[model samples]
Target: MVKQNFILFMLIGELSKKSGVSRDTIRYYEKMGLLRVSANRRDNNYKEYADNAPDVLKMIAIGKNLGFKLIETKEFLEFWEQNDTDNERLTEMVLKKIEEIDTKIKALTVFKQNLENALIKCEP
Candidate 1:
């Protein structure tokens, strides 16, 4: 079977398609310094994105999955970009995230118990 060549460079629209994020969201990320682009004003004039744009999008998705607000995600991304070699710091961040998740889980468990108790008292 022949392998298709993956495109390395993409325009904003194509990146949006590949990233599962709206163009406006990508633009907002760009404004917030979470993403960067290169433009070819001589030809197509549209912004050119790096092959790593997908990774950036994945980071955003991961942040959302971890219950981080956008601003918090931005700050985390900034820290990640600056401290690639600091494994200890990364571990600390991960531990903090785990703690936050634990807190949320406890709250959810309490809420579920309250709901179940109320349901047990309800008439059919």
Candidate 2:
């Protein structure tokens, strides 16, 4: 069994180091409602973050890497936090994202082919 007392709450600085996300980015996520901080303030008045903050930040990073906008990421995170399982909404979003990626890949391939053709013609 996991120890109940093992939970760790970190300040934003510690979370930034662990998650490889900047403090400014974390604050922006909080502003955008993508992340949450505890209501309880520290002695110095800085907000405390739950141990899961790093995981949430990592999720945001992955979502961004997958081409999700902040609003889309927030929607997905909200759904995930509520359901903890995939649903039609999430599936639809993912399918749409896949289509977008496919379109971009096709365009990039065409661009690459054009560049290669130009380079071949220019060879001396």
Candidate 3:
């Protein structure tokens, strides 16, 4: 009795295949409140996800690409979906991430230079 336009529902394996995110990561995100908490439960207790789950995964990926941790990404997405005014809190998060990256770059540069120096010492 399903219509051609009916929405598709996917189980964890299908979602993992469609979204390219592992089932473990999906489960983690679901536990962490990033994905839909009320995934439709079948009589056997298996969860069914909406077709749009892939899009949500993409949003999470985009947030991580912006240097946000999983928890931060969830919070940022919530704030973004609900807020309209000045995003000072999000700005602060971005600034802090930038500072962290800067410190890491400095340490990495020093480490690279040390490695180069060590290699030079080994040259004949």
Give Cα distance to truth, residue 9, candidate 1, Å: 3.8
Best by TM-score: 2
In terms of TM-score, which candidate is stronger, 1 or 2? 2
lDDT of 3 by residue, 61-110 (tens): 99888777998888777776576336888788778888999999999999
TM-score of each: 0.72, 0.81, 0.73
Shift in Å, residue 17, candidate 1: 2.6
Model 1 TM-score? 0.72
Rank by lDDT, highest first: 2, 3, 1
Mark the 10 consecutive residues where model 2 has the least summed lDDT.
1-10
Worst 10 residues of 3 by lDDT: 1-10
Cα lDDT tens digits, model 2, 10-114, are 888888898999999999999999999877666789877888888788889889988999888998888877875568888888889899999999999999999
Q: Tell me the lDDT of model 2 at 85.
A: 59
Query: Which segments of model 1 are wrong by more than 4 Å?
Result: 1-8, 39-45, 78-85
**Tens-digit lDDT track for model 1 on 1-124?**
1112454677788888988999999999899878877643216466777787878889988998888877777777877667664677666777888898899999999999999999999958
